[model samples]
Target: MTSKKLQVIATDKAPAAIGPYSQAIKVGDLLFTSGQIPLDASGQLVEGGIEEQTHQVFRNLQAVLEEAGVTLNNVVKATVFMKDMNQFAIVNGIYSSYFGDHKPARSAVEVARLPKDVLVEIELIASTVVE
Candidate 1:
């Protein structure tokens, strides 16, 4: 039998997990992140509409990714949870800017509610293998 060690990934740059969950977890060469809301490092939700909130979510994701020694470019899959599907276009634009040329597999869906009732939340899966 073989086992892959689990490494909890965290960073002060992002908001601390509010519940019994880690910011991210790395098992073997894969890093799986928790859903990040639009909360700052101090745990205060950012003030703004979908645009600002979405940006904050990305910032939080970036911090967690960095802690795992990976970048957005290394992300293999992303799951976005939005409060409203109507804002998909706007959110997609912001998402595009962050991802730039690296297009990873993504899934975005509208949910009834989210943590802190934030406009958007994002989670990602990244490859830690430095190839």
Candidate 2:
């Protein structure tokens, strides 16, 4: 049996992993990203409302995906965690704007809290190459 190789992907464009984790891990052709909050590259949380925070989260996600040799278009699945469920529609709008026509499988849930008290966090699983 052939064993798969796990590769850690890191980039200076995105906020560095704050804890004990890689920004993303690539196994074979798949890339799994850690949950991205609204933190900037300096580890400072972006100051703004939901829409702005969403943008920061996507920016971070894009950075990590790029480091893994992929783009948001390659995402096959996504998970969103929010501090409040009442903001679902707003978050959905921003998310749709980012993804455009590429609809990936997703799940969004309201969590008790998130790192840095941000309004939203996002994570993704994607292919290393666009199909």
> Which ten-residue region of model 2 has the weakest summed lDDT?
63-72
How good is model 2 by TM-score? Answer: 0.97
Off by over 4 Å in 1: none
Q: Clash number for every model?
A: 0, 0
lDDT of 1 by residue, 35-131 (tens): 9999999999999899999999999999999888889999999999999999999999999999999999999999999987888999999999876
lDDT of 1 at 110: 91
Q: What's the TM-score of each model vs. the native?
A: 0.97, 0.97
Could you give candidate 2's per-residue lDDT for residues 58-125 as a string of tens digits?
99999999887788899999999999999999999999999999999999999998987889999999
Model 1, poorest ten-residue lDDT window?
114-123
C-alpha positional error of residue 86 in candidate 1 after TM-score superposition, expressed in Å: 0.5
Give candidate 1's TM-score.
0.97
